[model samples]
Target chain A: MAPLIEVADLRTHFFTDEGVVKAVDGVAFTIPAGKTVCVVGESGSGKSITGRSILNMVPYPGRVLDGAIRWQPDGAPPVDLLALDPKGREIRAIRGKDIALISQEPMAALSPVHTIGNQMIETIRLHLGLTKADARARAAEMLAKVGIPRPKDRLDSYAFELSGGMRQRVCIALAVACGPKLLIADEPTTALDVTTQANILDLFRELRDALGVSILFITHDLGVVAEIADEVVVMYLGQVVEQGRVDDIFHRPLHPYTRALLGSVPRLTRHRPERLPTISGMVPSPFERPSGCLFHPRCDRFEQGLCDRSAPELDRYANDRVARCFKAGAGS
Target chain B: MLTYILRRILFMVPVTLAISLVAFIIIQLPPGDFITALTAQMAENNETLDPETLAALRDRYGFDQPMIVQYWKWITGIVFRGDFGQSFEWSRPVADLIWDRLGLTLIVSFATLVFVWVLAFPIGIYSAVRQYSWGDYIATFFGFIGLAVPNFLLALVLMYLSSRYLGASVGGLFSAEYVNADWSWGRVVDLLNHLWVPVIVLGTGGTAALIRIMRANLLDELKKPYVELARARGLSETRLLLKYPVRVALNPFISTLGWILPTLVSGAVVTAIVLSLPTSGPLLLNALFAQDMYLAGGFILLLSILTLIGTLVSDLLLAWLDPRIRYE
Candidate 1:
């Protein structure tokens, strides 16, 4: 079957006074149906911008410069989202019904003044063409489905009345209330405590299984990627540096950036050290990005002349994996 | 919620007393009583005041009573008989004098307030939503002009323009024929025809200030993650803005209700004087200048009470709109 969505050469940029910020430059990926594809990156790696671009909700001062996001819904013809007007009805129709999103901060992601049930029911009624009463019933059922206790009573409660965990659960319930085919969770568990984070991850897994929803999960934590992702896409400096099955990437990593990212993860099974390993140097500012390989300045295995002289395209290696480095898998 | 309202009402008693006490003390602080000022004025005019007449004047108004006793009399008179004492200048009950013009002042002030909100709300939303765009910049520039120019100056300019071009008298709350006339549809229509000048003059400054505040508040709210969350959920842009950020931005505006009432009555003093409008503003000012204690003090008391009521109304509204404050 064709992938649920195909994003090709996506380049989202912000035109500021100083210079253009290449927030997401020449990015490409696909999310297959019913699978969780986690995009792992540090801050400014453009993961969040990429997710926002899919919904055509890039804020002011920024615009999607070039890209083709071909969305192939289960029974409908493929739609080119970039071709549609960002503020027009055709794109709007695809945003909430076909795709939904949950963000990092639950406290900041729910409108404080509105009741949880009102927000949920609004989305359901908007897309599903249901009566207010039916929408309320569906919202309560959605809340219960997401493990919110006493969903009927909780319906009247405002977002401010709930705890952080409960708010995130409400956000999840809201996202899945419309039965979207795709859900983009942009670091949904980052603001959560450890226990709540686990529960939320478990909830995502349950959602994918029960609703057959494809998830484009964005996070900077490799541990979370390991816990929830079926496929992993590692990004560095606005470009996809590596992509493969989760086990393939974790067990036999290819890209040096991916290897370094894995090395930086704090392991519970390993012996203790005074200082944990960290990826050397900072992610360069978008305006001051280095020539050739963006990671060459910080790569431990950098080839002095070749890596700095020319950029290497993503090369397929072994079975069904791609890495941007010329020396893929050589270090291992 | 009922208990909260009840608690607020109970608290108003001591607050009202405190305000009244302070007002009385301030009124008495300047110098000797109105009798002294009157005698001085009479002497300046080379009029001889007979001692017997002076003593009788003092006796009639109870000026011979102690300060505490005088304050007690004033408070009790209001509490028991709804009388605000006698206006020393007009020689009538303060209540009767104030009621004569209070209705017109209220209509003018209320109309101005409604105009301010009606103009500010939409422009504020647009300016914030389209920050840095040409439309936003134009509104911002004009808003600053409104704030910087005094209302009296604006009133003068408006008066000049209206008389110069429109051939309409832009002064007072009514035409000459309707001055002190009984209420009628024709009178009301005349009042409205003459109303816009004062309303525009008085409301401009507040409208400018409120627009800036609304824009800033909504800007802050727009940057919040919830706005993005709502947008990502496919909410139409217009609905998202009005339902979320604008609602939050309206808090400060509602809280300003108490401050706005006194301003509605008092802040227009200079504007009223300039426009020659028959509002409480000029009356209060003239009374204060003449040391007409009952008239001045009554206006102050009435205004203070209005402020308290405005605060109570805003508090109730806040509790209704924001769930976080409902129980507390």
Candidate 2:
């Protein structure tokens, strides 16, 4: 299948008073049409920034310094999203109508002063050019699609009036309301409880199937990746260290950082260890990034001179897989 | 909502009574009553009041009675007959004096409120949205200057500049010719010409303070996740800003209504005196100085009632604006 969006060598940087911080440096990924691509990383790994850069919604002081986000919606001629003006009408027409976002903070994602119905109706009307009555009907239909009970009444509810779970559902409903081809969910289920998180993941799967929309899901939860991702992109320190089929990435992970991440997940074996394995050392502060391979300082398999002397390019492998490690496919 | 408002209104009765009692006591706290103040004035003029006339005046005004008995008479007369007692200085009913000035006072106050709001809202939004731009810096500088300079001093400066440069007669709500003239189109036009000076003078401090408040509030709201979410909805930047952050920023403007009413009546006292405007502020000041308890107490009670009403109106408006407040 053709990829819905192809992000190549995307470099987003934040210019701060202290110095310049390359937030998402040389990151590359692709989301296939009608497929879920989960971007997994620890905090500060630039997963969220990569997601935001796709929509040209990076916050102030941050710019997409060099990148090409080729969006080929419905097999139309490819449009380079990064090439368009960030504030121009072309990019705006693509946003929400062709690509929408679901934010992590459900509690703070919706305006407290506006009703759910008011917010939903406005978005529907803005992009779809529907009348108020038609927008209301569409909003109500979208709310019901996300399994919100009493969808008509729920439309009148405020963000603060709903539970955390219900709010996430509303956000999901909002994201998919315009029937965008690609949905970028930035840690959409991170703030929820375990059950609600599971329910939201299930909702994402159901909506992806029902609407035939692709999803770029950013998360730190391996379990969510396993449950929902068709492909997985593992990031470390603003770079995509490894990405492949979820089954291959989980069963036979290539990059040392990917192995370390997989090892850190707790298991339910008969002989339980005293403690779960952990990746040693902290994710270095953005300002003082280590030389050579970004993860070399903490890699247990770090070569004495080679790993510290020069950064390794992403090594392509069979089955459309890629890993940025010197010893990617060598025996562990 | 109706029940809530009614409950709040019912709750104001005791509040007003307590305020009236405190105001009446504070008015009486001075060394002597109105009769004593009159006697002192007479003595200053080298005139004397005989004991017989003095006793008769004191008896007639109920000054000879106990303080509690005097308070009872005052409260009963106000509640039962809507009379606010006689002003010792003006020899007129206290209600009449307040009513005569109340109209102009309200007009000035409401005009100033409108002026402050109209100026503050856009300037505040611009400063917040542009943030560190040169426009923001310029606005911040002017805001600080407005807040720092005293209103009366501003009034005086403007008065001086107008009289000197424009050769305009620069005091009162009308020109000298129209001071006691009947209402006419020309007089009304003249009043409008003079009204803006006092409105701007009184509104400066309020406008400056509200601008800072609005900017800070909008800046905070602009950072909320909801604002980003709104922008992601493909909403235009201007629409997203006004719909989300600006709506939330208006809370301070609404909540300020509680104090804005009382300030309307008495806030610009020095400024009014400096400009020679016929507002209630100076009248209330003189009433207190003359130890005219009824008139002074009446003004204080009116202020308290206005404050309560203002609070009620703001609360209702807030409830209308925010669902959380309404349900809560």
Candidate 3:
């Protein structure tokens, strides 16, 4: 059977005044039901772009150029979503009903004028056709499941009255209210403080267990990937450089950029003497993408002629791991 | 919001007082006095300019006193006794003349407003939803024509069309036959038909302007993140765009009340002359030409107050409708 959601060779670009920004270039990933996958990248690495492309929410001047996102509904026909006319596919029907998204900023993400109850009721009614009373009851239940206290009273409160942590919980409740099969959380907990972040992450685990929903999480923090992701896809300059089972990728990483990423992450078990190993230089822009192996200029093992000018495709190695760098396992 | 409104109402008192003082001062600055204009006809008839008769006329009008004393008498008489001195041009009290013309102007102004809003809202929402489509292009194309064709020119075209094709006559609030007839359905119908042309000519430009504002606001509102959330939640286009952001989008257009009185004044002027209706526009123009300061000043004062009230009404409405706003 086809994977529940399959995205292949996706490229999205924004036509800005300076030039066309290759926001997402050649990104590919998949997630099966009852599983979790996380896309890890630095700022401008196209993780968010990849997530937005799945829903075709990328705005004007930035459009999905080349990609196919196929969804095999649990019991429905396999839909080649890219080929489906926007109105014909009713892509929106699948969004809140089957695939929900939580954005980065909770405050901006939540509509200020609406009460939590109002927003939740609107979504539930649209997707489930639940009566107002039934939808309200279910909304409260979902809110409690997301660890919001006093869900009944809090329902009547406007978004402004809620704390950042509570707003995040409300957003999570809104996303999962209809019991969607997949949740696309794009840095959903990034705005919360440490304590709230931990609680929200734990809530995610609990909710996942209760609903059997898959989550395609996107974030820049490696620690978050380690905490919740079952599998990890590392992206750089719109291309996937490494991907594998979480444990394999963490313990026996085979790619240079992945190593640099892991090195830069400040682990709790730290006794730094002089310098924290950092990834030097900036990510290249779309127009100035390196001639070969996009990370070649920034790679520590820079071989002048061999590494700088030759692009390498993804090469699979032992243990079902794939790395794009030519010097994955060998030191330069 | 109620407290804020009350405070604004209280603040208007001092502002109005200052306006009244300025009006009195400017009206006093003219070279010849009111009695001089009053007796000009007698002088034109080659009679002696009688000093004693002029003094008695000035004393009766309270113009014989010093400027500040006369101003004090006028202000007090109006504020305390509800008396605006007689109009030299119309041979009626200033207040009575305003009372008669005020109702006619208001009815026309209000009818025009209703017509414009009703026409603009749906067209604007349509254009925003299918922004570059044929429907939008058609609406915007007609909108450009409406905006570019001055109200006066449109009024002329409408009058010509009605008279030439429909055998109608350009006229006032009601037809000559309807003036003597009782308020029956047929007379009311004829009156409405006569009123329709002026309303359309004046309202078309207003509707076009409002449509542009609504389209821009709706487009901006649709780009907001909350709108995205609404879309992601499977809310239909109708619900998402209209329900979630309608109020946010309307605030700017509604808040644009700062200049509506001037717009109304301009509209009334054009409609009054083009429609040949007896609104204050023609009256004021005639007054200015004949140097009738009493009628002109009173008309200007009434227009100024209407402008202030229009802005106040808009602010009150915005405050009530948008919950996100706070007085503090």
Candidate 4:
């Protein structure tokens, strides 16, 4: 079957006064139906921007300069999201109905002044074309589905009235309320506590199984990727470096950057290192991006001449895996 | 909320009392009482009053009483019988003089308030949403000009332009013929015709300031995460803006209501003088200048009460609009 959504050569750039910032530079990934694809990267790696670009909600001064986001719903014809007007009705109809987004900061995601029910009902009524009473009923049902107790009373409560964990649950309930086919959760659990994070991840897995929804979960936590993701796409400096089954990427990371990322994860061994192993250099500033490989400056196994002289294409490998490196398939 | 409102209202009692005391003291701070001011004017006109008649005048007006006694009598009269004492300049009751102008004063003040709101709200929203656009630039330019130019100067310039180019008689809420006429449709129409001058002149500065405030406030709100989240919910641009950011941005507008009541009675005093409008502002100014303590003090006390009431109304409105605000 065709993938639920396919992103190819996506290049989202910001036109600032100083220079152009290629935030999501030539990135590609696919989210299959009823599966979770975790896009893992550090801050500014453009994972969030890539997610936003799929919804055509990139903020001002930024544009998807070159890309094709082909969205194929279960029974609907395929449509390239980029071809539609950003503010047009067609894209708007798709945004909350077919695809939904949840952000990291739940406190900021929900409006402080509006009741949770009011916001939920608004989205429900808009997308579902239900009357006020029906939408409200649906909203309460959604709150209950997301494990919020006393869902009827909680609907009237303001965002500030809820705890951080409850607020994120509210966000999740809001995103899945419309029965969207694809949900782009941008670091949804990053701001949560460990226990709450586990609960939320469990909720995500339950929702995916129950609703048969595809998830593009963006995060920097490798453990979270392991817990939730079926497939892993590792990104560095706005480009996807390696992508395969989560186990494959974890056990046999093809790209040097991916190997370094996996190496940095703390282990449960008896011996403890004084300092956790870390990738050497900083992610280069967009304006001062080095020629050839963007990750060469930070890669420990950096080839002095070749890695600096020419960029490596994302090369395909056996067992349905891909890595962007000159030494792909070579021993780590 | 009811308890909160009751508490606020109860709190206003002491506040009103303190304000009345301050107003009386400030009115009295200018050297001499009404009798002395009358004597000074008489001396200026080269007409000397006999000592016996002067003593008799002082006795009749109770000017010979101690300061505390006078204040007590004034407060008791106002509280019990709604009397604001006697205006020394007009030789009439202060209540009578103020009541005559209060109607027109309220009319002009309310009209100016409406005018400022009607002009500022949409323009402010536009300027913020379309920041740096040509429309925003034009509004910002006009807003700055309105802020920089004094109301009296603007009034004078508009008066000149209207009389010179529009060929209309300038100033006052009524034409000469209707100045002393009884209430009639013709008089009401005449009042309406002359109302715009003061309304625009008074509203310009307020409108300008409110526009800037609204723009800045909305700009900040538009950048907030909820606004983007609302957009992601598939709401159209206009609906998303009005429902989220604009609702949040209206706090300042509602808070401005607290000052509107006092401004209704005393705002644009200089402009009222320049235009020769028979509003309470000019009446208060003249009373102050001539040392008509009763008249000036009455105006101040009325304004203070109005301010307290206005503040209460604004607080209630703000609580109603924003769910997060709890009146404790």
Candidate 5:
């Protein structure tokens, strides 16, 4: 099936006093229908920005300068989100009904003063055009579906009153209340405890299985990526360095940055290295991204002359994978 | 919740007593009692204070007793009999004096409070939502100007301009004909007509400060993840703003009610004198200057009661509005 959403050559830049920071510079990916695509990147890799760009909310002082976000609804012509005005009515219709988001911080993702029921019902009423009673019923139903106990009572509880896990569950419930086509879960489990994280992940898979919603999962945790992702896209310094199926990316990471990321993960069933390997050098500040290949400065397989002089295109690897490097999938 | 309120009320008794005691001590801090002030006035007018008359007056007012005994008598009289004592200057009951002027003072304070919130709310929200826009800049500029101008100076300027250009007497609460007139629709209108001058003068600083505060608080709230989540939920910018960030922002503003009442009343003193308005502010000032102990103490005690009640009301309101505070 065609991808539910296809992002092409997207560039989101933040204009600040220091300089222009190309937060998501020419990065692209897609969320296939009914599948979870995890975009893994460390801090400042533009993973969150990529998720936000799909909703056309890059925030103030930042603009999506060039890109095409073609959202393909079932049996309908693909809508180019980049073409729609960010503040206009058409985008508003697409935002909650078609594409909803579950943010990372559960505590900060819900209004402290408003009850969970009010927030959920208002969104439902606005988009689904349901009456207040119907919206409340739907919200309670969604809450129960997300595994919240005493759904009716939970509705009246404020965000701060709920535990971190419970709050994330409510957030999930609210996001999928309207049966959105795509859910952008930006590190939805990062702030949660390990047990709660597993439970939330299971809930996401169930939601996908039941509702057939496509999910664009953004995170830096390789463990989470391994657990949930059908496909994986590795990002570095605001650019996509590798893209492929999760098994392929994990077992056969081609880009130097991707390989380094995989190497940094702790493993069992083997002798442990005395010092855990990490990707050398910090993420370059957005205002001062390196020329040529952005990751060459920290690449373990850095070529003295070639890797430093010109940027390599994302060329094909075996089994329909892509990587940006002079020597793709050679060493291991 | 009932227990919490009951506990708070119980806690307020000692606090109020302490405040009243301090008010009494401060009233007594000046050189001598009302008798001294009376004698000085008589001396200034070159009239001798006859020794027999002085002794008789001292005995009658219990000035011949020890300071502690006099304080005990005063406290007992107020607590048991609800007597705020006699205003030596006006030779009337202090309660009657405060009661007569309390209505006008409350009207002015209440009007100023409403004016502050009404003007600040929308402007503050606009400044925050459209921060760095021209509207924000203009609102900020005017806010700073309002903060910088003294309330008394503003009162004088407004008084002069209105009297000069409009040929209207905007000084007192009522017109010359309605000054001592009985209640009537015409008198009420005249009172309202002159009410705006003091209200505007007193409200300008608070309105400006509140706008800045509201803008800052909402700006902080607007950056929270909930706001973005709301936006992503496709909540229209207006509804999303009002429902989430503005609601959170209002907490700090509401909590200021306690401080606001006292600040407005105290700040009104100079402006009241400047505009020649017949409010409690001018009466309190004169009482303090003349060492009219009962009148001064009465005014202070009333203000203290208002302060305590304002705090309780704000706390209750905050609990009602915010669930986190309510449960806590």
Candidate 6:
């Protein structure tokens, strides 16, 4: 079957004072139905940009260069999300109902003036056409579903009265109340502690299994990917360097960039006591990208003329996994 | 909510009292021999003004005593019996003076507010949303001009043009033909006819101020993440702007109620002069110049009370609109 949501050849760039920052340059990926796909990258690697672009919410001064994000709902023709007029009610209906988004900062995401229950019920009422009474009861149920204690009483409490975790859960519940087929979580646990992050990840897994919702998870933490992701995509400088099932990605990484990233993670088992295999150089600025592969500046597996002058395409590795590197054919 | 509101009202008493006390101090400053001016005028009508007689006038005006004693008397009378004593300039009881002019100013102010919000909000929102478009540029051009040009000049032009256009004489609250005519519907319409020019001119700067404030606030709110989240949640752009952002943006403007209310007095200065309305601002100006201390002080106290009440009302509104703000 075709992917549930497929973004092919997406390019997003920003025109700024200093130079054009090609924030998301020619990235391609697909999210399948009922699967949790985690995108792992550092701060500026354009992982979050991919998530935002799905909703057509790239902020001003940053324009999507070109792409067709096609969506094939259960029995329908694949609709081009990028081509839809932003103001049409059809797009609005599809947004929170079919695709829900939980943003990065939960504190900043929720309106402080509105009580948790007010915002939640407002959304339920808008999407479901529930009566105020029905919406309230439904909101309370959703709140409890997100593990908020005393859901009925909590409805009267403002955003400030709730803790950070509770507020984040409230955000999640609001996003999921309509049973969106696709839930895009952009680093949902960044502000949370380790234990809370684990619990939250577990909650996401439960959400995917029980409700049959597909998740597009974006984060910088490889640890989170290890716990929850069924498939993983590693990105650098706005390009996906490697992608595969979760097992192949962690156990049999082939790309040098991916290898450096996995090696940098702290391991409990005693490995050869060597300095952490840090990537030697920074990702090149978009304006000054190397002639060849985007990762050539920091690729330790680089060979003299081949790595510097020629770009590489994705090559099949051990499983159906793929790595975008010149020497993927050579076993490490 | 009832308890919270009751507690707020109870707390407001001291706040209002404190403001009134400050008002009292401001009014009492630098206007020496308040009673002498009136008593001297009386002396011109062949009344012999001896020292004892002068002291009696002073006592009657409540100026022969210490500040504490005068304050105590005014506060006691105000709290217990709702009396504001008398105006030395107009020879009218202060309460009666307040009663007569208060409605006109309040109506003018309320009308001005409605006028501004009705015009400025849409204009401001349109400007921000279509930023740098001709509508934005045009709105901005007018906003700047509104800030630069003096209110009095606008008042003058309005008076001149209004009379010329409508074949109406541009003087006081009513046309000369109806000045002493019975208070009929016809006369009321005539009153509004003359009143419109001053109201428009007086409210011009305030409306402009509201426009600029709303524009800046909306711009700021539009950039906020919550607004972004609302849009992402499939809220229509209009709903996001009005429901989420405007409420957040109005906090700073609404919080300082005293300043905004007292702006009416400033507007009233131009309004009374332009329309020849018999409002307290013009009366206060005349009394101050005539050194009619009792009359000036009475108006000052009234203006100050309005300022204080404006602040109190804003505080109450802030609490109501934003559950986040608390007085206690």
TM per candidate comes to 0.98, 0.97, 0.87, 0.97, 0.97, 0.90
Per-residue lDDT for A1-332 in model 3, tens only? 45678888898999987898888888877787777889998898889888878876776768888988878868467676666554333887887889898988898887767778999998899889999999999999998888888999988888888889889999999999998988999998899998998988998888888889989999988888889998899999888889888998888888889988998887657886747879999887678888878998888887888887788888888876788887888842
Tens-digit lDDT track for model 2 on A246-304? 99999999999999999999888825656888999999999999899999999988997
DockQ of 4: 0.73
Q: What share of the true interface contacts does each candidate keep?
A: 0.74, 0.71, 0.55, 0.65, 0.82, 0.56
lDDT of 4 by residue, A274-311 (tens): 57889898888889998899888887778889999999
lDDT tens digits, residues A1-332, model 5?
A: 78888999999999998999888988877778999999999999999999999999998799999999998888479889989988889999988889999999998999988899999999999899999999999999999999999999999988888899999999999999999999999999999999999999999999999999999999999999999999999998888999999999988888888888988888775476667778899988787778789998898788888888899888888887888888888878
Model 1 misplaced regions, further than 4 Å: none
Q: Which model scores highest in lDDT?
A: 2
Candidate 5 residue A258 C-alpha distance from true site, Å: 0.3
- For A99-202, candidate 6 gives per-residue lDDT tens digits of 98998888888887888888888888888999999999998998888888899999988888877787788889989988799999999999888887888888
User: Which residue window of length 10 is worst by lDDT in model 3 chain B?
Assistant: B319-328
What lDDT is reached at residue B136 by model 4? 98
Q: Give lDDT tens digits, candidate 3, residues B1-328.
A: 6778789889877887778778767766767766676577567887766788778766777765787887777778777988776776677888877766776677777777778878988898888877889999999999999999988888888888888999978767678877657678987687677778878887898889889888888887777778887877777667777787776677766675655556666556866776878677888777665556567667777777777787788888776666566432
Docking class of 2: medium
Q: Cα RMSD for candidate 3?
A: 3.7
Worst window of 10 by summed lDDT in candidate 6 chain A: A270-279
Q: In candidate 4 chain A, where is summed lDDT lowest over 10 consecutive residues?
A: A268-277
Candidate 5, residue A142: the lDDT equals: 96
Which whole-number lDDT from 0 to 100 does residue B141 have in model 4? 100
RMSD in order of candidates: 1.4, 1.5, 3.7, 1.7, 1.5, 3.4
Residue B206 lDDT (model 2): 93
lDDT of each: 0.89, 0.92, 0.81, 0.90, 0.90, 0.79
Task: Give one digit per residue, the lDDT tens place, for model 1 in B1-328.
Answer: 7887899889998998899888888887887777888888888999878989889999998888898999999999999989899988888889988987777777887898799999999999999989999999999999999999998999999999999999988888889999978999999899889999998999999999999999999999999998988888788888888998899889977887667778877778899999898888899988877788888888888888878988999988888888777855
* Interface RMSD, candidates in the order listed: 0.9, 0.9, 1.5, 0.9, 0.7, 1.0
- Name the top DockQ candidate: 5
